[model samples]
Target chain A: MDLHVEGVKKVYGDGPTARLALDETSFTVESGQFISIVGPSGCGKSTLLMMMAGLLKPTAGGIRLGSTPISGPPPGVAVVFQDYGRSLFPWMTVGKNLSMAAAADKLPKAEVARRVDEALTAVDLAGTQALYPWQMSGGMQQRVAIARALVVEPTVMLMDEPLAAVDAQTRADLEDLVLALRDRYDMTVAMVTHDIDEAVYVADRVIVLAAHPGRLIADIPVDLGRRDQLTTKAEPEFVKRRAEVFTLVRRPAATSSAGSDAELDGRPSELKA
Target chain B: MPDPSGATSTLTSAPPPPPAGDKAPTTRVPRRKRPFGRRLVSGVSSLWLLVAIAILWQVVATLSPTLYFPPLSKIFVQFGQDWFTGDPSSLFLSQHFFDAALPSLRRLAQGWGLALVVGIPVGILLGRSAVAAAMYFPFIRFWLAEPKSAIIPVAVQIFGIADSMNVFLIFVGTVGLIIVNTADGVAGVDRMTLQTARSLRISPFTLYRRVLVPAAMPGILTGVRVSIGVALILMVISELYATTAGVGYEILLNQQSFKFLQMWSAFLLIGVISVLLNVVLELIEKRVLRWQRREGLSGQ
Candidate 1:
């Protein structure tokens, strides 16, 4: 099923303190597309992902999966949060954590076990079913989080900077792991990240977002056929896309349509552009 | 994996086949295992201060005993004779153990158990609702701040010298801590975890059972841990207020009769029991939160 974010706008508060978090964001993630959302910190990338996951309500417009407008958490969507350490229940073993995705689906005990096993093994985490998540390294923990998303057998997997809290080496390893997992699961993925190179490295389409009332800026496609952690990064197309996304992120959005000019209002008279 | 695309295994390093012995092949993971006797000795090493204090007390008392400070050896002897003199059928536990210790334990279990069973849910409710928290949190704060002893007279007036009075007093004294900690724990659940649970579409009941409760468990257990000490203190204090047969009452009787040696022995028993209670609670917490522990990865 395809996901559509239709003219969605989010406002934080009302009256004087009202801040526009997102502005009439619209996009349709084609089925099986690997879309990477990249921006500077305040771009509302996480907010957009949360809304897509149906964990947050858009103040205006709506998000739809297939034809259904999502009022609650959507049916065939799963999420991997950035903070892998805190995202998992510190009380459950790796097996129990993955089985949780199947809990409400009412799968049989054996089916739940099968899915859990399959998901872990899919992420190269086979035989770790009995271990606790925290006992593993940060890299391994993130793999379990990814495996958790896989267990749901979701049509769409939304990751909120899932590689942010890991070491550089682990991040590189995980970036490839994610690419492979996407191919293996055949699930559409929308990963929100700030790292420009990573955004271009793994995504088929890199959606550049601008902050100060975050809105979509550009949707650049990466036509790189096959990718490697070493060679693909040095490819001429990859370097150009990285620089393009980097410039868009740093250029400061030209438009802020939510009509809250606090970013400029707080500036000195001469500094106002 | 059953997936035919298992060809992607080259993308990430393969997880070593599960180890047959102790450690995994992952980056040198720390293991807490040691030789049995050494492990025991290391664990016991932490108790050295207590043993040293006991020895000091004994040496001081035997050499130059004071009227107020009775000899430690005599107190130990009294503790043995009083607690271990029951018939064979009673497993050599004396009348004092049956009447005093057993009653104390029963009241402790009931009151403390009621506090936890009732308090955890109430705390979660308080945590979930801003209106409820606003209405009750101040009152709870006032109660917690006020010495629990101040409430004993109120308890006495209602239950009046019955076990209910002691139970009531213990419940009142300790329930506040449990409630406060549980509420804080629930409130302190990681925002990401809650978001993940929401995205997973966990049912309301399952969310509470699987995500909310487990996330708040460390806090709940902290409250339980703190309440253990509070419960023990309250149990003794409640007994002192009024009770016919209890460990606290035994202390009172011995003190009144000037059998300071017996009083001291009863005092030591409370210390022993307090330590035992802490150990038991810790074991339960460790088992419930085995995920938080790394050393004991043996059993499921």
Candidate 2:
């Protein structure tokens, strides 16, 4: 189903020193689309995602999944947080974690077992179900987090920098895992990331957000053709697109008027849109 | 597809052909077993250390018999002859074990049960509500430092020289520890977990049963462990003061009659019971925290 975030604004504190974390920000993800949001640190990408996940209520505006208004976390949305160690229960085995989510949804025992097997195999973690989270390496723990989310068969998966804690090589492997799973499940995903290459590599469309009173500054499509870790990064178009995103991200307020659509760094706003 | 055993194998294995490939289903291999010799060495090492300590104690007692030391051999002989003869008339088994040890165990159960029943809910309330914590915690803290054993006279005055006084003393001594631990455990649950549960739309009852309890379990277990020791101490102290039966009273009776051997034996019994209790608790802790060990190595 299409997810619509409608003019959601979030304010922290009150009066004088009050900060606007999100200012009338809005976006949409068509069904079965991969959308990545990239911005400078502290630009409220996480806050926006949390609002959409129904984890946090927006001070103003709202989010909707098709016809249903998201008063709180939507029924079929699963979140993969960065700290896998904290997100999954330390007392449960990897298999139990998946089963718990399935059981929570009141799935039958047979269905839970089938989904558990499918999720573990999908993440290349089939045999390690009996292993505890701490027994695995950092990358493996994160995969289990992904597996847990997948077991729920969420329609819209919200991943907040899920690969930020892994080694460089492992990060690339997990990125490919995401792509493979996306194709297999036909799932809609909204991932918040600070990595420019990652945003361009994984996303069908990349949303560039400005810092300080965080707002959507650019919405660019990344048409780098078929993606593989090595081949996609090697493409000249990949490098060009990443450089464009970096430039838009680094644009200072002085260069662009507050209300006008003046182009920054001589690159037309058309490329961004 | 076969499950890789180690990091090296996993890295070398081709990423399993995309999910659609018609590869045979993977089977998991059994984990490698530790070498028998290594397992034997670890098992014997722990027992050897205890044996070494016992031998050293025996050597010291044999060489210098003057002061207050008894040889390990003599102690064991006395223990075996006194308690395990299967003789119904034996002082150790008949009078000491039945009359004294059983009474102490009974008193301990009564007091600790009361403490748990009263302390846990109160602790949970204080832990969850700041106003409740602020109002009650200071008074509780003030009482914790005061010697509950010194109130034996008051207990006797109120409940008389009966099981009631023994139970009262244990409750007074141990309830404080239980309350403090329970409150800390409840308060220690991570804020993020609570937020996650709330966002998941978990019902209030399920939130408490599943999230709050599990999150607070380590702390609660710790409290239970600490209180067990406290309960044992209070059981002995209360019996020593006014009770006519129990291990503590037996120790006092033997001391007064100049039966030093019997007094030492009673003390030994208490020590052995405490150690055994602690070992049982350790096993339970290990079972509960098996998953905890697998969590990423953050500082304890």
Best candidate, TM-score: 1
Residue range with the least summed lDDT across 10 consecutive positions in model 2 chain A: A264-273
Q: Residue-wise lDDT of candidate 1 within B37-104, one digit each (tens)? A: 99789878998998999899989998998866787878889889989998999899888688789999
Native contact fraction, candidates in order: 0.40, 0.21
Each prediction's TM-score versus the true structure: 0.87, 0.85
Best by DockQ: 1
- How well is each residue in A1-273 modelled by candidate 2, as lDDT tens digits? 999989788877766546777667778899988999988876789999888888888988889999899887677888888777787777777887777666557778899898988888777777667766666667778888898888888888989889988877778878878877776667899999999999999998998887665678778888876677758898888888899899978787345323422332221222211
Q: Cα lDDT of all candidates, in order? A: 0.82, 0.78
How big is the positional error of residue B88 in model 2, measured in Å on the Cα after superposition? 12
In DockQ, how does model 2 score against the reference complex?
A: 0.27
Question: Whose lDDT is greatest here?
Answer: 1
Taking the tens digit of each residue's C-alpha lDDT, what string does model 1 give over A1-273?
Answer: 889989887877766567777777788999999999998887789999989988888989899898999888877788999888778777887889999988878889998898887787776666677777766766778888999998878889999999998878778767877777777778899999989989999899998887766777788999887678778988999989888888888885664233334433321222211
**Model 1 accuracy (lDDT, Cα):** 0.82
Off by over 4 Å in 1: A234-240, A255-273, B1-30, B33-70, B294-300
Worst 10 residues of 1 chain A by lDDT: A264-273
